[model samples]
Target: MKSSLFKISVLIGIFSIVIYACKDKDNNEKLEETVLQGTATIYVDQTLQPIVEDQTAVFESQYNVKLNLVNQSESEVVNALLTDKTQIAVLSRKLTKEEENHFNQKKIIPKITHFASDAIVFITNKASQDTLIDLQEVLNLLQEKESKIKALVFENPNSSIVSYMNNLAGVKNGQKKNIYSLNSHKEVLEYVSNNQGSIGVIGLNLLVQPFEDTKQYTDKIAVMSVRNVKSQPNNVLYYKPNQSNLGEGLYPLKRPIYMLNYQGTAGLGMGFASFVAGDIGQRIILKSGLLPVRIPSRELNIRKEIINNK
Candidate 1:
């Protein structure tokens, strides 16, 4: 009787251990399999917020996911990603070597994917008669040299546009007295619209496809045509920030937008990143007036016979 009782007790202990192990395995499997469902926070450059918002809206509606998009300056976005505050970020530029090295130390390989092309556009008040701007003159303005521009307004001091223009003009520190930095892109538009002789530097996405909130100001501002400084004096060509110009590489202020995913797991970040790079997301980009990384194809059927009746 004593031996039988001991055997029964051992079997019960083994069964409990097996059951606990199976439960733990099941929980892990569920966590690993959840791709399109979960919460993810994505930090996006302020300049590209309009388009990113559009992408997020569609993505959230299509899947059981909640995307918290934090619109911030370029520097802030990079900081968030490096600090692990957020696992995903959208920016006009890719991560620097030092940034990638930091991730390498942690055994994480970031997935950077280019999704679209954007342009930096210059806008002025409608009252201004100067409908065209010379690229050299713009560079000269950035360099604090005398130029045709009276004043320049930027979205933010730390924005990608400011960095891009500074690099282009070879400006190490400080800016011209006439140059100014505001809090947001909308403020830039409002200031330019209300104040004459002020040229606003903004992203092309807002002007090309204005959102409801920005349409009022965008309607009041006039987009200026930019002349390429590299072009010969006699062969200088001015291009506008349109889809055709961006697609043909005629726009000199064009920049590529990239999505960086550092989730390091099959989480919602991976799913959202895939969605943005997939067909539906590219179509949203195409409709937003930005140049999608991959142009969605269209099929058309042609009839061999044409009937003309008068």
Candidate 2:
């Protein structure tokens, strides 16, 4: 009887150990797979804030999730991701090789999803007679060559627009004398609207959906159509950063928008990334005046009988 009791106690101990192990495994799985119902913080490029806010609103309403968005300059966004401040970042450009190396050293591979196409637009005061700008002229201004515009105003020195223009113009060091960096896009708009001969460089998203306080300032400014210098045969077509122009690649200053997820697990970051690349998120992009990565499908009904014209 003593031996049998000892055997029963051993069996109970083994069963309890097995149960505990299984429970721990289940808990880990739950933590890894909780995609639609958790809290996540995302760093977003300030220029893309308007459209991203729209996406987060619908996503949070549909799922039991909370998204905290930190809108900063593109450089700050990249810095936050590299420093592990956030696992997800929305940017106009992909990570550079050096940036990827940082993640490689940490054994973290980022998942990048291209969601939409955005544009860098130039705006001036409505009273300005120059309604059209040549792409080459803008580059010349960046290169410190003589140009029609007196100065170029940008939101932030570290913003993506400034970086893009600098790379495009092949500027090695500081910006040209004519280029100026302000605190925010609003200031750029206001500065351009009040000062003639100065042009504001801003994201098309702001013009599409301006804030209530800045609506009047938007009206006071004019969006200039850009003449593409890269077109073959010296094409004379000028295009504005409208939906159709951006979709057809006619816009001269177009950039791709991407969502980079470094969560390395099936969490809310993954879920939000999927949501942005999915059908509904594309629709949101369409409504926000930017070109969706994939055009949403439309179903049309056909009738055999033709209706009489009224």
Candidate 3:
């Protein structure tokens, strides 16, 4: 009877091994990131943090995945993507041809999704009388030419705002002289609010839908409307960064927001890209005081008759 029991136990153990081996191979692979259930790490440009945070919170609540969001400067975000530190990034600009080639050489095709529209914003102390800024004058100041502005404050030197303004001003060297940079956008706001005759350049999202950290500074700083000098002087219009201006392409400082995915498979990046570019994600953008890629359609349900259940 002891020998019979031993043989029976061995057979049962073998059966259990087979059952475990056959069980849900798809769910068992924890290393791979899937569409709805897995892990992912995304690097986001700090300027776009507010809106991305809203999307991330909603995405995490609805899905069974954890997204490690690293908000840093635009250059850092791009470097992380090129060096393969990460396969996904949210940027204020697109990858250059050379940058794209680096990934292509590794047999990874980049999938870029233009999700929303954002712009560079100019702000000043609330007590200041300068409510309008000429884009040309700002560019002139960047080039070290004569300008009305006393000092210009900006976020991190490595941030996208610096790159965008440098490119626009055609300044290859550096914005030294009257230009200064703080550690963060909120610091710039605080500096501008305290300093007289100083202007702060930041992303529009920070000024529009401010996070809790920036809420206190929102009321202290005044957003300046920008006018393009290239337009006829008499008919020039100073336009603020707003939904109407962004949608109609009247905002001169506007830039496109992109999400580049190089996961090379149906990974969590693909899932997030689809989610942000989809109807629901676009709606989130629309409500965040940013311009969505495609406007979310409004549904009107009309019934032939109405019934009062109550």
Candidate 4:
């Protein structure tokens, strides 16, 4: 009887251990299932299309998520977020106060994160001698009713771009004679590349890095410089757009690039938001000739043995 009781107790102990192990295993599997999975639309501005398309692909591959991107203007993207059309938005600027109010009314505070930096580049044909001009000069030329020089923008429907022009030119009366808009940035580039007299105002990311074996974009066009705002006649200036110039604040047209989210912690949007603020992500921005908001310093150590090696 004693032997039988001991056997029964041992059996009960083994059974309890097995049940506990099974429960723990099940819990782990459940935790692993909680991954960022879903379909989300990233409404983007036309200005960021060229750059965002590449970044989105890389991000999707890194994080197992599907991003449905819709190309639109900044204002359009903001409107889409307010209307519950998209969960994420990538644009040049953040939401205005009125847009913020929409989120607040819904008891949600939108998240705004600065990912990378960009510049509004001015490009002119190689034949044009007018390579350097101040913002005042640009304003004067764009606002002058009698000026013969024509200015081309990305799109007429782009209110943000239009507003920038209006603010810079101080156009209270009406639209200027020379200021016009094109269908797309590619169209603007092609038009200005072929026409020696035209000046093309476009986002810098499109033409920053060159293509196979040569400077693809620069072959067709020459980038102009904005004169220094402080110097006399603004003679001293940075001509070409590069990481150094942009990082050092020599680039006059630099703008803070942003990604806005209507909600903070519910979707793949948060994942992307966190990644953009990470070091590896910021490095991608640095590699693109654009300044990263969080700069990282790389330390290289060359040993004496390696130096003596060849």
Candidate 5:
């Protein structure tokens, strides 16, 4: 009977070990990721930092998740993604074909979520009398051709705005003598504010929603309305970068903002992308003065009977 008891005890210990092993296996299968729960690092284009910060604040407050956003220049963000430093990024434009093929070679599928429409804005010192600029003049100035623009200040050469303007002007780079690049958008705005006849090219998000420290800089600058001179000359009209103009496709310098996920699993990247493309996220974008991909729906209540008050 003692021998039998010893054998039974050995069997029970083995069974317990097997159970614990299976539990460990199950836990390993799940990476602790769910729709509203997980930790993620998101790389955002520095120009879009303000708007994204608004989205992340609301997202974390309502969900059991923590998001760490690394805001850098557009090139830096893309380079980080390519080098496998990160799997999530937000940019003003979608990934190019070459960038997509890099992941394709690695058999990693990318999820691109276009959430909002953002505008590239031209700002000038409030003291300047020029309130509007023609698209041709801007392009010509970028091409190193003489134009009415005295000086064009912008973010660094690697920034998305510089690329957008260069692409518009059909140039590889902005080598114009009058073109100047600063370390950041804040610096560009400050320079424009302090200098006369300097147009600061910046993202609309910065001007529309100013942070506490940047409010003074924004207060001293004015958005320069842009006229699309390439289109019908007689019917040309100047447009300010605003939600209405972006939604109507009337804004001359606008781009789609995309959330790119290459995490390859149903991870935090997926959750944040869905959130930004969802109703609540869209509402935040709307409140941020940009155009959301889908305007969040509204519900109204109607009263059929009214009571009179004495």
Candidate 6:
């Protein structure tokens, strides 16, 4: 009777162990399924919000993946990537050597995807006569001892606009007077639209939209052109910011835009990056008066005279 009782006790213990193992396996499978359907958070420069917002809707429809996007300054995005706060970051410029080294030290190989090229455009009220400015004039405007010209920009605390301006103007001196950095591009547009004397500088992505959607805004403000100072010194020949101009390298204010993915393999970052660099992604960029990384084919309209001569 004692031997039979011991066997029963041991069998019961083994049965309980098997049940617990089965439950643990089921729980792990459920967790993995959740991860496969999970959402991805993408942190990007504020200026690229509108561009991405539109692209996200289309990407979701095709990929069945959701993008949880957060808009902030480029600097903020960089900081988040360093802290593992985000998996992907879209920015106007590539990472610096120091930043690259930081990731390398951590054994994180960031995937860089170049999607579009945008030009920083300067605009004044439609009624204002200041249509063109030389690089020297812009430098003086930003660095002059006493200046009254109000230069407007977005509200982000750390913006690439300021740095890009400094590079173009060679303004190593210091902050100039009358630089009224505003809260957002919308506010900058409104302020410049209302005030004729004020000049607004912004990314070209802000102006990209369907012709009907953007006509009202573009009509209110006229974009100014920056001349090639070294090539055309004292001559104020200005080239407007347009898709053709950007492609031809006529826009002096143009800058390359990139998307950096720190989280590798099967993450939301890779999904979005793939979409933006693909054919569809590039088409969207082309619509915005910016140059896409993947060049699109253009239909050349040859005039009858030229065609006949050839």
User: Considering every candidate listed, which one attains the maximal lDDT?
Assistant: 2
- Per-residue lDDT of model 1, residues 179-211, tens digit only: 899988889988988987678999988677666
lDDT for position 34 in model 6: 24
TM-score of each: 0.85, 0.86, 0.87, 0.78, 0.88, 0.77
Model 5 error, position 156 (Å): 1.3
RMSD of candidate 4 to true structure, Å: 9.6
Tens-place lDDT per residue, model 2, 1-310, is 9999999999999999999999999777653337888788999999999999999999999997889999999999999988889889999999999988878888887888999988999999999888788888888988888987677889999999998888888885375688889999999988888987678999999889998878879888999999987877668778989999987788878999999988888888789989988999999999899999999988899999998999
lDDT of 2 at 74: 95
Predicted structure 6, TM vs. truth: 0.77
Which window of 10 residues has the lowest lDDT sum in candidate 2? 26-35
* Ten residues in sequence with the least summed lDDT for candidate 5: 27-36
Clashes of each: 0, 0, 0, 0, 0, 0
lDDT comparing candidate 5 with the true structure: 0.88
C-alpha local distance difference test of each model: 0.87, 0.89, 0.88, 0.71, 0.88, 0.74
Q: Lowest summed-lDDT stretch of 10 residues in model 3? A: 24-33
lDDT by residue (tens digit), candidate 5, 278-299: 9999999998898999999999
lDDT comparison, 2 vs 5, better candidate: 2
Name the candidate, 3 or 6, with the larger TM-score value: 3
TM-score of 1: 0.85
User: By descending lDDT, how would the candidates be arranged?
Assistant: 2, 3, 5, 1, 6, 4
lDDT (Cα, tens digit) per residue for candidate 4, span 1-310: 9999999999999999999999999776542211266556789886766567667777778766777889886668878988989868888777778777877887886777898888778888888877765665676676675443456545544645665566556675345566677766666777777888788787777677533432544678888877654456536654566777877777666777788877555667777777776777787777777778979778998776655555
Task: Please identify which of the two predictions, 3 or 5, would achieve the higher TM-score against the true structure.
Answer: 5
What would the TM-score be for candidate 3 when compared with the true structure?
0.87
Sorting all predicted structures by TM-score, with the top scorer first, yields 5, 3, 2, 1, 4, 6
